[model samples]
Target: MSNKAGSFLRNLGQFSPLDPRSRTLRLYPLKFSRPKISHSNWNLRNLLLNDFDNGIRTSIRYLFQDPFILKSGDGSLQRKGISIATFLRVDRHHCPRRLSFDSKHSLVSAPPFDDGLKKVNVNPEVSGGAGLSKEINPPPISYRKLSQECNSLSDVLDIFSNAPTFPSSTYFSAMWTIAKRMSEDQKRFEKQLMFGHPAFSQLCDQMMKETRIMYYDHLLFSLYAMVKLGVPQNTLVVQTSLRMVQERINECDERCLSVLSILLKEMDKCKNVDVLKAGLRILVHQQVWKIESIFTLQTVMKCIGKDTSIALKKKLEMKALKELDRFSLLNSQHMFEALAAMNHRSVALLNECSKKVIDNIHGCPFKILVSILRSCRELQYYNLDLCKGIADYVATTFDIWNLKQILLFLISFENLRFRPTDLMDLLMKKVVEKPESLNMRNIIFILYVYSSLNHTDKCQHKEFLEVMSSALTGCLHHISSENLLKAMYSFCIMNYFPLAPLNQLLQKEIINKLLTSGDTEKNVSRLHILDVCLKLDKVAYQHAIDLQLPLPPPSLSLSHSKVAQVLSSLLGGEEYFARNVQLPNNYHIDFEIRMDANRSQAFLFSEADVTSTNLRRVAVLCVPRSLYCLDLSHPRGFLAMKMRHLDVMGFHVILVKNWLMEKLKMEDASMFLKTKIYSVEAHPTTDVNLHNTY
Candidate 1:
């Protein structure tokens, strides 16, 4: 039956394949030149090909791997050996050299590098060797074997360019396998090879021209490989396959539909595929838990946006929520990172993610930890346990932390409105120790932490500011307008006026951008603070962009009301204080009272419709607890500057803290007010001579 090449082809129908419907054919023994042996001792029974990815999906593994031998009567092919089903490996451009593995037949043209392939002994008991069959079957190339043998990009390209069939997913597999074994430099070249080289173009061209794909899986198999490699969705091969799938949309199941959506998103063509996305989300929701790759789920999450219907987004989120347990620690970090990057917030999901991060804190990578913190901050999540764990890990391991990492950690904690005390201390120490590592942006954050988080100032802070000031001044020209204002004003908050950096910021273009660019209202508030600081510090630089901040009409805060009550008891009536008085410069005062600098007597600025020229004026700026640094009586940069300006304007600035007034008993409150008001006379509001106690 194996004697003639034509006979072998003819007899293939006679042997019943294990799968009655198996389409895979065996072509291993087309070595059918009749060797004139009416063969004595050789029995060619039980010879077969091996199975592949599916049941009875056999193919050839020899020539590139171990070749199984089958023998009977006198010898043995490993009895349990599995042989792959071999077929013709066709290249329309070049004919492949042929090989035969029939009993007593040796390889025709094996490479010299191989020690040798085992020679088959079909008839050990038979005295003489069989003559070679001239009709050897062409060998099928194994992608796995090609990947194993190649050691360089050039070799891969050579294999690709010479004697190859294009539009094969197996080729994608081969490329990646080679890429994995390549050095980092070669791996980078692998990407450039696909992007800039002609070999890739030919492959894509063949994909476009090839009309032989019989199954959707073949096309999607290529898509899967591309996604894993981060291949650009704009690549010709990917675009062609996308069109193919869109054309075959009705035939595609959910899995293929989701894959198409992901590729379209990568192409930034989600709008073009909006209809597909609607259905895609539905299919993914139906099968969310079935998915095991969190990365796949993350990519799926990124695909939905404002264009997607809210109902569909909710469904997808809910399904993913139920299946979040499917994620590992690292994967959970990635999942929430995508959620945060997309600016999609889910309370339950983030809560779950916070727990995941904290639970896995000991093993977390710094990068993943940063991502987790971003999710929390961006989504306004507040998990104290997670915050503490992250802070502890970071503080203990901060030798490895870079400037960017420290900045992100600060921003996250600052946003969460939770002070990571140890982390903050460590950062302060780092700044004092290595001020050179800081840039303009980091200097702003450092100033902010000192200005906002530090209650009682440390000597290191002054040293930090001294070192930071020079670095900040050097880079002032390169900073953005918003950043310029923030850096200067943050220093103002810390009570160190950088006259040089401030002068640099007062340019016409910078001031214009500060007043006109993004978030102008917030920008102007910063400008107002800087203006107050500059004037109070008596540093002259003339780029005053006039701004009138709207003032609230006469009203009293609860703290002001509490202060009003205390003042009325001391000065004989509620009429002794006027509330919500706007200063000539338009800064609002919480209350105004007329008292001698001694505070032995107090009266209203306009009691009984008469001005009090005899009494020194007091501007009581009632501030919320948020206006102060956490757990401290220290006011933040803006509030501090406003007070200095008021002091310059001839009103002794008396801080009326809402936190203090709101809690004080009447007896103690009156005394507190008296002490606060009278202390202004003992030690006046020091503007020019004030040192930064931050």
Candidate 2:
């Protein structure tokens, strides 16, 4: 053992130093020395063996310097000992000038480049391999072709699994291609990519780092994919995708703009105001004329509300309206809704849109037309040509409209004061055809329009009133107090009441509720009930005397007193006249009289009687010729529709020109009142009895 140990120590090129204190032999320290190998003559095994002898202290640089050893296609150096097998394989086969290592075989082989693949030379600087002069570059494969070649989802996952090794653009391109092909099967694709496989999540993480350089389409595809995958909007993935869209919006084409619009709408659905604002800013700055861009601006305006600056809203509104001609019917309709929501009103823009609506009225759907009409009414922008066109369309297409739509159309027309009588008649016919569908509010609106347009005496007015009355009686319990009052008011204005049974039902069921309920905050008030009762009661004197309702004091002003004195003498004795009777709603009737049971009268003695009923036969409003000649359309005109609320409630409304009353003698005044009120054509009788008051 001692000799063997000594010999091994000697072979290790170590010398023993004598110990002075101890006479015994001590172990010497071993020294290691590498054997020099000739690079020109030695085989790879020898070099490897030499490296092994030195405990494998060889540097990668030294291995790369070997001439026989070729760099692998991936730029990695071949294993030192393995190069011998690669060289032998190449030498024996007499392979082509360029060789590639078979990764599976662990040996060199001839190039297996396919003829279909076109070789591309990648710049070394781009590849970050300054030493590499040339290499077998990968073919520029398109996403479409890649998707075609990938037979299964695993194949797609394989590409994503190796995403870190590939360039970001190449990886994103592959992903985009796969996503496009799988778009038709979005639910399946989403399941597999988002949940079924881990590679997709890993790839997402890697791609996020390179989002700044991602192409617009690639970003859009990623966003769409994530959205389809049901990713939460608050997630980093969705936020990154939105950021990428906003960044590239300016350079994007129309298709990209559309994608951005869809993205904004989705964000709006998510209530992501910040992201929506960012995208809208980019769209507005780009001034892209595409319809999608316009819609995006509109959506942002709607979603952000007052958070969106007024200046910004106006800018976007102007920008969107400039392209109104390019908008389709559906687009125009959506634009109108958006504008209405934003409360953006431009007369010129409204005119342009109105023209478009008129041109395409026939093609427009019922709901869309209703929306347009409502928008116009909300904006208070009434275009006569547009309204007439809508009316014509409604007249022809009334059958297709639902009950709600018919009511909306009619109410819009009434608001604009653009009465289309034919269309209105058609609407009335439709309502009568399906009276069961009419709710209390709809009834009120219909009656209101009829009264406003003065169509109470039209041919079908009585039949229409009967249908609405029946409908109202059936649903009296369900009617709200406000709607009930409005319906009664409408009935008064039209001067066409229901028959006895229906009238009693309305008075008992609807009017009783209005009188008792305490919801006076809304439009309906207590005074409306008084007017309704006055219109409903055939004999005004019996109603007042029985109900114990006090009459309003007559106006004692000079003009009113003069007219009242003449009216009193003509009708009967002064005791029959009551001055300025105040109703529950603060309305005052001027000089109401107790006439014969068949003809009850409430009189507005002069143009100054602002609260008198307009029902021609039930009430008389005497106005001077100057006042009568004024434009009735003016809000404050003496003959304006607003002068009376009781006209539509079966009241006989009369507007008497009293220009000659001031100059006439008492007998002349009596004759004038007789001819106007009683329709008396014969000479007056000598008897001054009150029996001739009728």
Candidate 3:
């Protein structure tokens, strides 16, 4: 059985050396009359007839047309160890002296240089290599090796040409590797490399011009590399660069020039915004032009509209009217529009232009005024008249939201000297007149404005809450309960900032609104409530401890739900304050006044005696005090704990009654309190012993 198994395995190995599907068979050993390995060139016919077996000859003919190797001049077979030139030199010497060479490989062959002849001085000192020996002629360098280095350079350029759209770190890595190899002595090619060459300015310009929209990042990276490689920013190079870019700007693809023009202008000005804006004006041809050009006219008018200066206003009107006269343009609508919007020296220009255009029945001058207003709005150049112009446009268009945003913008602007109350009134009228159109964000914004402008000592101002709630409930149709709740929370927090009428009652009502409107989801309402709780808890604790404010009235306990919810969230969590915190011996405490009249309680635990057994606790009682005093004289009192009351009164109260043994239990605590005889306001040393109790 073992012999049979071995034979079966050996048979499987028999045909494994050659692929069965291949028609060609190997002709390993040829039978020839001359030594089979002799150095000679023989035809296929001769080899087939005299050397190969019949089956091998047929396979060899099918696989290849010419399968023989040439012999050396020494009549020895050329193999791996023979140098190529030696084989060539020796093989030529073996050919018959009389035979004419007709082979293609030998057609271009030249006689080898003579060793006896002294070389010419043309290349006697090759600059890069060591001096050559006079005794021996150096072998000609290989084309094959030079070709390989050329192939590597080609590969580097190919990689650069096909760079991925969004370059990854790996792409940069590959580039750095290729750059290292090609730029072995990189400084040598700094003048020739495309990225380092002045000629590359044209390439960049061509790319940006060819595409309608440039990937600004790619252009920036390329330009950054060029600048880093010491591309000089002189008059000639800069002009050349600008000329290339100007060609693109001429083609009207402004986006391509967006980053490019910014670079060129700011590069000279060293990142100055003013210089960049000036450069943009030049790039867009926003300068003096033939008075016939409407674009130039419009741009000049727009710039003048955006400027607030009274002096500059007169100057701009003079410039525009002069340009209008240059074309002898009689009362064109464009000229009339520009005249109407000018702040100085344009009333006559306006009357003339408006009369002609009106005679021609173009009464829609407000359209032009609105366009001017919109442009100046973003530039923040609006005044009362401009605001009125915008309001008039709003009245016509009924764009209440746009009007609100514009009003909000005006309200938020820092440098505006005009009164905004009138504008606010206008917006409120719009809101009241069209309730369905107003969204909650607008109403909130209005309220935010009210809060910003009206924070003063006047307590009679209606609570913003009622206004906000009414607007929210009545005007806003699509508001979700959850967002409404969160908005309320945010509003309450904002309210805390201004010293407004705040009380436990108001806070309780706010909390009720929050929880009632919030989603029950842990994320939705719970997190928001917790946020409010953390804020309020700090306020509550501070008021209780620092201001010595009384515990908030139990009637003002709408916040209880929120507090309970937060407590439930914090259960078993390390985030809560623990009773066992290793507190300092002389711990300092501070309190800050927050929302309404609430304050914050803060504990400052410093260096501690970790091994100490007794802990000190200070508890405060009462509301922010209208009266207070400090007592340093205390001989009889044990100075049990520092205590403060609502009147800012400090007391060195002696906790003379240690934990009553029965007080540890609830029933005992109740009985002890009921039995102890106490005064309404007892001094610290006034020891009232409970031994006289019934």
Best by TM-score: 1
lDDT, candidate 1, 189-223, per-residue tens? 77776655556544544443331232455566665
Question: What lDDT does the true structure give each of the candidates?
Answer: 0.58, 0.51, 0.33
**lDDT tens digits, residue span 367-440, model 3:** 45444334343434434444444444444444434654555454432123233444545555555555556567
Better of 1 and 3 by TM-score: 1
Q: What lDDT tens digits, residue by residue, belong to model 2 across residues 284-376? A: 444533335455555555544445556666776777767776677666667767777667777877777777778877777777777777877
How does model 3 fare in lDDT?
Answer: 0.33
Give the per-residue Cα lDDT of candidate 1 at 174. 67
Q: How high is the lDDT of residue 496 in model 2?
A: 47
Candidates, ranked, TM-score: 1, 2, 3
Put the candidates in lDDT order, highest first.
Answer: 1, 2, 3
Worst 10 residues of 3 by lDDT: 623-632
Better of 1 and 2 by lDDT: 1
